[model samples]
Target: MRLNYPFFFIFFLFFINSTYSYSADCEKPIMPSDAEWNSWIQDIKEEAYTEGISKKTINQELDLITPQKKIILRDRCQPESQITFDEYLYYRVDKSRIMSGKNMMKKYKNELELVANHFNIQPRFIVAVLGLESFYGKNQGKIKTMEAVGTLAYDRRRSNFYKKQLFAALKIIDMNLVESKSLIGSWGGAIGAVQMIPTTYLESGYDFDGDDKIDIWNNYLDIFASVANYLTSIDKNPWSSDSTWGREVIPPNNIKDIYDSLKQIDPKGCGAVKRRSVPKKLSEWKKLGFKKINGDPLPIRDDLEARLVAPDGIDGSKFYLVYPNYKNILYYNCSSYYALSIGILSDEIIK
Candidate 1:
């Protein structure tokens, strides 16, 4: 065959330009010096004051903090671990985690049931989210919340997001919702057993036990209720008590071809949702050769609709027929891997 040198050269140029663009986006900028950080903090305080945060709260929380450059570095280098869905699931839904989840479910049975009744959500799922986020409240985070959010707010990328989080953290302090000294959490500023950010805590955190505090850190009642509240309050499609998130399945040998034809025509919601096949009745999926993992036929019903998701794509080892409730889990954490882990863990917790 004759060599297409010109075509290869053009492809090389395109590849080089794409790589450079990606590198440019990921490149880290210089960390701010102490003087620069102090000045930035002053500006932040002024903004917080305008947002109605108390002056005392601003000075007390914002004054003594130093920039956490390590957080910014971690944020910039947030690794997208290159692994298959099975490998991801292996670590997230292991034997120990499942056992711990079961134990937590039993230990907090009354509280979990209360939240379940109040929010119309399953108790197992609430436990699964808590277990996954903080390992049953063992590792919520060690970083001081103000310092972490403040440092990230000062950084360039995602400045607005972290800034909002910082103000919310300050507001939480101002309201005396949580003690300032106890306000420590993840490097990214998510707090408490359920690992909610400040804004979410403010909006959804509940005083379920009626101590007049939404103490997600040490209060399993608040934590469980908050998770249930977040799920039930998701706009449009909320969690359905009658259905589970999704189930594992075996797709047809021609799944790729089937998916190409049946994939969502109008991409909606997040990129994850867009990647899934359009909603087909369980009967329809059964007709198309999809079956439960145990080789049982899908329910022979047209009333129920489900979307097909091969998170690792058609060639991967697993596939799911997810329900609308699955999208509610996505609202909790968008990734298929994260949502799937929550679902599988929840299933195992009750088993």
Candidate 2:
């Protein structure tokens, strides 16, 4: 059985209370007048009616939308300086999570195999990601989806993303798959076992339980299937055995960040090198002092181009040999650190 979020309703009550304490300054401000609050609700009603979101959905969602402080903090915060990849992964990949993930692998085997068959995803990797994202659903987060979306829309930092997510959250409630009280998620709006944003959940989620519904919260099979389907939609199952996401080493002195000009290579994901072009065959890299960590032949051949990235960079202890399939990890997240962590976690679990 999949883990269900038990406190989702409590979070909702808090959010509903936050709706009226309209302080514009966040840190220090006065509450909006009754007229202003009513006007805001009126606007929401108008949008709900026009957009086909039911009145029930609008009322329920609005009732649960309290302003959250974390959203404001995340929206306003600037990017911090870089942390070491090893340190990042230390927190990201750990023993207990992987052990729990392995158990889930056993518990959900039949459904996972079914999803893997259709999507061609390696089940271990998917399960590893599941463990990493939400602790196998033990902690899906407590922030109300409505509040986070509303906060983001009002904040104006990445308004397009937040607004789109806001619309998607309302649509989820309107569809009746979730209650407003049940729409709790990460501070950024990722929900349930898969950590999917509301838009992604609505766009591509699946129902493998044969319930005629897609529920990411209560159905383990459906959640795994949805995630597998999402991965396929992003890359047609680029992580399959025939494909390679691992990278070949690059000589530190020889390569420039040419991949910067190669965004056209991805359908939506970035190239292996972000904006740079991929490297040439193993033979090419070998000629350039790029050898395998195992002292064996580099996995890639000379005929193919690979993304050259070292999470540790040139001065670091380890190097990454990237393949086009490896670039597919970025579709899950754009960060090289994130993708590498997933790859490494997948490796650790598989081993």
**Which candidate tops lDDT?**
1
Q: Flag regions of model 1 displaced more than 4 Å.
A: 1-29
Q: Rate residue 136 of model 1 by lDDT.
A: 88
**Taking the tens digit of each residue's C-alpha lDDT, what string does model 2 give over 198-246?**
8888876887767766778778888888877766665353455565457
* Worst lDDT 10-window in candidate 1: 1-10
- Report lDDT (Cα) of residue 245, candidate 1: 88
How many steric clashes between backbone atoms does each model show?
0, 18
Error of 2 at 191 (Å): 0.8
Error of 1 at 6 (Å): 45
- 67-174 per-residue lDDT for model 1 (tens digits): 876777656644332467886677678899999999998888888898899999999989998777778899777789899889889885778988999999999989
How many Å off is the CA of 204 in candidate 2?
2.1
